[model samples]
Target: MGLLHRFANPGRFLRLAARLQPWTNALALVLTGWGLIWGLFFAPADWQQGDAVRIMYVHVPAAWLASAGYVALAVCSVLSLVWRHPLADLAAAEIGPVGAAVTAVCLASGSLWGKPMWGAWWVWDARLTSVLVLFFLYVGHIALLRAFDEPQRGYRAGAILALVGAIDLPIIKFSVQWWNTLHQPDSITLTGAPTMSTSMLWPLLISALGFSFGFAAIVLARLRAAVMEQRLRVLLLSRGNAAAGAPS
Candidate 1:
């Protein structure tokens, strides 16, 4: 709580994020570029799917970000609702568009992968449907954040929507198990060893890490810009008021 409040100060966050941004950007580029090259050109092809399995490297990371990004947004929502921190609100606002884009990537890659393996571009499989719902939830959160005339009201409303929409995350994770879906059960699990061979697993892991770092880099950059913009607005408003109060 003490730590949260300390970083919740916009100036403090800006300083910290500024220091972290360049490093994150560099790491994201190096790692993602390396992972994509390794996955696409060097990783052993799946016996079953052949080169088509390469898409997993992209799809898996986007899927991970789609859910993980929403979890971050929900945490921001909690901070806003419980503490009414404007920084939390700003963070949540920045997360929405990025989250939505990642989710779209997840959906598009999944569709492309499916068309090759499943003979169709899309299926109403349980996991696929749940992920689609997650995308819509992101869209709704973004919409609510801008719907109100007052920014505070918008933040509060968006926060509530984010909290409620969090129910979809669990559903997305378990959808394949709960229903007889076209999607397969998870290849990787916390309790069980990965079903995928290490040759493939290593590249996938690297790709996911790269995407995670990239996502963090983007959100931090946007949050810093938002804080600066808010400060500029406040400065301008104060100047306007001061001018009005002074003699002509």
Candidate 2:
């Protein structure tokens, strides 16, 4: 808890987030834009899919961040529940919608990719179904946070949902192998070199990094705003109580 204690102060974190947000946003925009351009033009087209294969650049990274964002939310949920860290609640609240938005993007892009490749805009393939469930989990997390009247009550409920929803992440990862699916097997694997050529892989990696930085920027900005809002609420309530108690 020592490491956690150091970062417990909301004011300190807001200051740090102010310093970091611009840089992360800039990095995200530049890298993601360049990657898209490179992937669409310079990277060699897939022999099988030709120009349509470029959709992988966006779809893959959005899918990666959707899951990664959920993992972060789950970790924050645990911290909020176990340690009662104020910042942890703020993190879960801020990150939930971002995860949901990215998950939507992932699904939309996957559908776009599927139309030409599979001749269907939607399918019940194991991998696709798992990802769809992941999207719903994100939505549930967001909804749960907003469902309660008291802020802390909402946060606690959302945190529990986040943890339970974490079971979906592993399912999403292994669904391709656990059952037959139309989605291709992993092109990049842990035990062996990536099957893709360097030309195609490079842009995808760049786009992933870009999206990651963008996600960081958005999360930080949101966290800073949430901290400030809570701070303002505290000040207003304190003032109201003082005025009410004074010589009435």
Candidate 3:
């Protein structure tokens, strides 16, 4: 508990994040590129769906990150409200739009993949509807945070919304199992075996990992920018005040 607070300072976090960003960026680029090439060309096509299944490498990662990002935002919001950690608030705020973007990608990619498989572009399936709602929640979170003149008020509102919106996560995760749906059940699970063979699975795993790291790199960079902007604004405001108080 005591050690965790040591990194609560924005300066220390900024230094740590700066040191880590380059490695993460390079890794994201390398791994994602490798996964794309491997999945598209090297991996065997699906016996049923053919090459269209290759789209899973992209769609699955986007969908995974979209949900994971919101969970992160909610946890950060909890820390912000309970501990009043400024960095937590900043992280949550930055995650909102990124999550939304990924969710949109997931939906778009899924629709594209579904058109041939399902003979339709979309259906109001449980999983799809819930993910769509999650996207909307992210957008609302971003908008609410920017709606107020006082930044703290906006943060408070956004935090509450994030916490409340967390109810959707479990529903999204369980939707295919709990109800009749056009969406398929889990292809991979922890307790059971993967439905896919090694050739098909490796590229998907690599893509997912690369995208996850990419998300972290982007978020850390955004957090650093927000911290810098805040510091700059404070410095400028202080200078303006000092100049106003000085002799003409």
Candidate 4:
């Protein structure tokens, strides 16, 4: 609670974010560029899938960011509900659009990857369908956040929706195991040795880190802008009230 309150100050957060953004942005570009080059050109082709497997370099990262971004959104929602953290609402508002974009990339890349591997652009497979649902959840959260004229009301409504939608995260994770899905089970697991070869795995991990950094960079930049905008609005409103109250 002490730590949360310390950083919850918008001005303090903006200063910290400003210092971190350049480093994150640079790392995102360098790592993503290097990983893509290595994965697309240098990584050995799969014995079965061959060159088509290159798409994993992009699709996998986007898939990861989509889920991870939502987790961040859900965290913000919790902070907003529990602590009434000032910055959390602003963070959630910014996260929704970015999360949606990442999810869209995941879905589009999955479709393109699927067409060659599955002989169809899409299937109603459990993993695929659940990810689609995740995308809709992002979209709905984005819309709900803006649905009310009063910002606080909208934030509260969106926070509840985000919390409710988070139930899908675990379902998305275990969908392949739980159902007969065309999507493959995870090759990488925290508890077990990765099934993927090091040649592919190294680049994939690098790309995922890069995407993670990129997502953080984007959200921080957006949050900073939002905080500044809110400050400006409040200043403007106070000035208008002051003038209206002044004697003519």
For lDDT, the strongest prediction is 1
Clashes by residue pair, model 1: none
TM-score of each: 0.98, 0.97, 0.97, 0.98
Model 1 score (lDDT) = 0.94
* lDDT of model 3 at position 64: 97
lDDT of 3 by residue, 1-248 (tens): 46557888878988988999999999999999988889988999999999999989999999999999999999999988998876888899899988999999999999999999998899888999999999999999999999999999999999999999999999999999999998789999888999899998999999898999899988988999999898899899999999999998
What CA RMSD would you report for each candidate?
0.8, 1.0, 1.0, 0.8
lDDT of 2 by residue, 1-248 (tens): 88877878877777777888889989999999989889988899999998899999999999999999999999999999998887998899899899889989999999999999999999998878888998888888788888888878988998898899899888889888888889887898788999999999999999899999999889988888889998999999999999999995
| Model 2 lowest lDDT segment of ten | 10-19
- Which window of 10 residues has the lowest lDDT sum in candidate 1? 1-10
Score each candidate by Cα lDDT. Answer: 0.94, 0.90, 0.92, 0.93
Provide the lDDT at 36 for model 4. Answer: 91
Q: Which parts of model 1 have CA positions greater than 4 angstroms off?
A: none
lDDT of 4 at 161: 94
lDDT string for model 1 (86-108, tens) is 68999999999999999999999
Candidate 1 RMSD computed on C-alpha atoms after optimal superposition onto the true structure: 0.8
Order candidates by lDDT, high to low: 1, 4, 3, 2
Candidate 2, lDDT over the whole model: 0.90
